[model samples]
Target chain A: MINSIDLILVLILLAVLLSLGSSRMMALIKIMALQGAMVSLVPIFIEPQARLSNGGILFFQLMLLIKAVLIPGLLYMALNRIAIKREVEPLIGYHASLLVGLGLVMLSAYITRRMGLSLPGDYALLLITAITTTGGGLFLMMSRTKAITQVIGYLMLENGIYLVGTALTKHTHNIYLVEFGVLLDLLAGVMIMGIILHNINRAFDDVDTAYLEQLKD
Target chain B: MLEAVFCLPLFAGLIAFLLPVKLGRGVLVVGALLHLQLTLLAWLSDFPPLLPGYFSTAPAGILVLLVTSFIFVFIAPYSIFYMREQEMQSEPIFIGSMLLFLGTMSMAALAEHPIVFWIAIEATTLVSAPLIFVNRSKKALEATWKYVLICSVGIALALLGFFFITLSMDRAGIDVPLTFSSLNTAAKHLDPLWLKIGFIFVIIGFGTKMGLAPMHTWLPDAHSEAPSPASALLSGALLNCAFLGIFKVHTLMVLAGLGDFSGSLLIGFGLFSILVAGIFILKQPDYKRMLAYSSIENMGVIAFGVGIGGMALYGAMLHLIHHSLLKSSLFLSAGNLLLGFGSKIVAQCGGMTRLLPRTFVSFFAGFLGISGLPPFGVFVSELLILIGAFKAGHPVAGGLFIASLALVVAGFARIVTSMSFGPSRQEILVPEQTLRIVSPFALLLTSAVLCVWMPEPLHQIIINTIAVIGGTIHG
Candidate 1:
């Protein structure tokens, strides 16, 4: 039987896959929300003996709220207002993207095997998941044409980084205040992206970033 | 006191947002003055950080803070006239965001801890996005989108790099605070491998925001699309704050005895950015975009100088100061040209000397200063960098540096001559104003003055800033 941490990692991986394969904008947002929840939960389970303080607990809750609820809510609101039904034509096809996602996971696994660092138990899997998630997020950003979809890609990348921070660092260095600052910055960044998406939609009558090509040299 | 230097801007930004447009403009200028005063106090005194682990006024930080504050003082008043000329609808947002951008950049400058520094840099991207989007044009929207998305993604990688550094400490069992000072002291004991990996990501991450090439795709668009005053702040001040992040990490690498590795990386990125900017600047369409590319090239010069170390590191710091002054002045002048010609394309703008003679003077002088002509600080700085590069056994990089500089100057000369003398496309749309003309001239004059006579205090600060990397003015 898989442990709770392993189960969560699997779920997170599954969310990344779903995000890449899903064409519907709302479905991708849901995958991101799931990934956010799993990412925030990783710190709690991965360092069970660290004994989080009251402030640490509160920080995690705030992270959960922002990552899972507030950011996705903003994206959802943007989706409703802009009314873009789907990412109809990606720069890369869905099938090629899935293959790329698989290749990324395999590559991460290979990297983790060769690194030969003395990490805590199960950290190899954590590293692999983080790497795959990051690569997949970047791939999504490059392959998608829609502005909202690109934002989702960015969120995925951010979530992957959050996982790396959790897997690699010791809990002692995890100052609650600093972590909260990072969370707040992420929230503000997403909100700003959402606002820009609204403006992009209104100006061009579509959220497709293809229209943004007019600014080039 | 250091807190006041940043916090005052935050408070003023909020008040500016709430107040009417006219009063908001006053708040911006007042906030800039107060910020400059506070920065002077912070520079002169040794005020402990209110949040001890997070923020401090280090030598490098103070240099950047002084530049940011000084530029804002000029850009603030110039923005008043700019907004009036453009007849901007979101005047309050523009004013508020500019002040807030100042606050965030100041925080990035003052941040001591790695994660705190990352957060502050990321916050700078968020606060400054609206400034790029303030024009509400489709192009502005596109630029804002790229700025926010590219910078956010790049900085996330930086966050990952920060975690890697912490991992190095954890592996080595070093329990010191995560501030740059503490990290430097503990560098020798830390794990070198992870530290190297961390430095690479931090460079790439912060380098993107600093407008270094390969990751510099977002810069020209954002810089050219934003209003002139906002463009001035972005090109002049924001990029330096990002450089401070990379510089602090490079200091750690130096302390860890991995200076050669980090130095080579900087030199590589630096030279490549110069080459890219040089190629693009040739036959560039938009004058604002050309200035933006020039900003990239100057940043490349600084990085190249710092990487060469010894006297070149001193050149890098000098380049940072002079570039900020000259480039912002050029952008401000470009703003005036935009108002007069109603076009950003160089082909559409001609006979600038006859059309807007005062702006032409400032613009021409700014172009000279940025191109490293004599009597400008950039000339002295670039000369030192080349000399230091040769002395440091980087003769090949030094040669390439000169080639790139020549190419840039050649491209820029063609544009300047054509813009100043070529046939006019249309009548001037808006007459040049005294307030608009004064700021760019004043900024160029500041660069010229600093070139001829460096103040003792500022000279000392530059020495202190580069001393960690073995930078000395005298070979």
Candidate 2:
């Protein structure tokens, strides 16, 4: 039966496609923020009847805050700092990327069906969305030229992995602690990338990965 | 008490961030010494984990910890002298980041929980990024960018692998804690299919950080761009932390009766890395980049030996320790060369034999030692691995191993000869100092001494480390 969890998962998939096709950096950041919030809410929806303790409530809220507000906020600041607006001249054009995104959905669905792991409560849809988000993130990284976009892609990849972790493993006592640490690392990684983005802009007048090809062997 | 081995350096690093540059340098050295003392204490005595579930002193973890601590004791002091000659934008940040990097690596070594190990490793990448970019040059910025983005993504996959491992346990109806030690004990119950998938992802994830080829693109650039002492630590200590992650998982695989699958994969990556390093080292322009590729080669050697099992696993352990010592020494001596000639390009350097006599001795000796000459531990380790490979009935792979070693040595010799004996080209920029030269010599001497006389405790540790995987001392 259709439920709120599937709705959220479907929205996340749409956001992934939108991110792949969007030419503007600001729209991409917004898409990521929406995707992050939706992804963080999946665990709550999956286990709605298993009332969360105080610690679990606080952990989920913190996850939502970081995933939705902090990370995209950092990217937004980084975008403004670098002063780059539109993603110019992607390696793959927008239309092709959109088509590829659809292909990724089908691929993920097939794989999820092939390895049937008796998950509970619309988790098949969740796994498909997770795999598509991951593949989309990796594709974005390889196909985009801007460093900021690559960071966005990395965040998307991380969100997908987090979803996989949630859907696959049962919640243990220390799981929240580990997840919190991962969230903090995500925050710090974005901050460091922001600093490097500013430097890359100052040094080269652009944040394009094209200019970073000098030191290669 | 075991936690203090990492905690001491971390607190010191936080203080280094606030202190003045002069005092920060003092903190760096003192922190290193205290860390070494704590490491010795943990090694010599039984120091129980403060957090029993997440942190423990396993044999493999402690071995990596000891090697890291020993290398830091020398690299910390060498960094002080190395930094004195050149001005950095933020000296305090550099020193602070070095200590934080040490703390993260120590945490990775001693971590028993899978997720905790992943956290420690990811923290290392963040902390060490500052060390690479301390110079703030454009190339340094590029290198830092690659190092962070690549390692973060790579380690993210490792986290996914850990999740898969947890999933395997869940599928088996096991309710054990998620530490590696517990995972090993419960491994036989895990579904083999999921375990295999987890190992693939884990190896790719950790192997990338360990500088295994096909994922080692960031290594040469980051190592070459980082300041010398930072490069030394990256080569000597940081890579071992990543290898420890892979080694732990490989042991789990062996326990699960997946040794052949994991071993073949390790051998494949190992040989590929050696080939890649050999090809790149030939016609290499930068001396520092050459040393970085050499690190990739050594990592490959260690992976190969471990994959072969039996006597070769013991060789891998010896190689791990000796590689840390000799490679750090080489990088320090290369630092002296950079200080003397003011260039990293080999063609721009010449007549180090005449220009800097003391550095020349250490550099040439390091070259010989790294090339697997006698009076050094690499020679012994390489011989053991080769013999182990043949005995394991992998004659073709053994032959390729020897061929690649020859190619690497030939390329390495050409570069070393020209750089040391080529016609005099440039004037010395900074005169050699006793402090700058002593650490490298001391590091090299330690390797030689260990080769001649294997310490009882270290030997016992190696035995304990490989005993689970069916590795024996006698061929």
Please report the candidate that would top lDDT against the real structure.
2
lDDT for each residue of candidate 1 in A1-217, tens digit (9 for 90 to 100):
1388888998999888888898999999888888999899888887765736556777778888998999999999999998677999999998888888899999999998888767666577888899899988999999999999999988888888888887777777888888889889989998999899899989988999999987777
The DockQ figures for the candidates are 0.89, 0.81
Predicted model with the maximum DockQ:
1
User: The CA-based lDDT of model 1 is what?
Assistant: 0.91
- Report how far residue B433 has shifted in candidate 1, in Å: 1.3
DockQ of 2: 0.81
Whole-model lDDT, model 2: 0.93
- The sequence of per-residue lDDT tens digits that candidate 2 reaches over residues A57-146 is 888899899999999999998898886788889999999999999999999999999988887655798889999998999999999999
> How accurately is candidate 1 docked according to DockQ?
0.89
Candidate 2 collision pairs: none
Query: Which runs in model 1 stand beyond 4 Å of their true positions?
Result: none
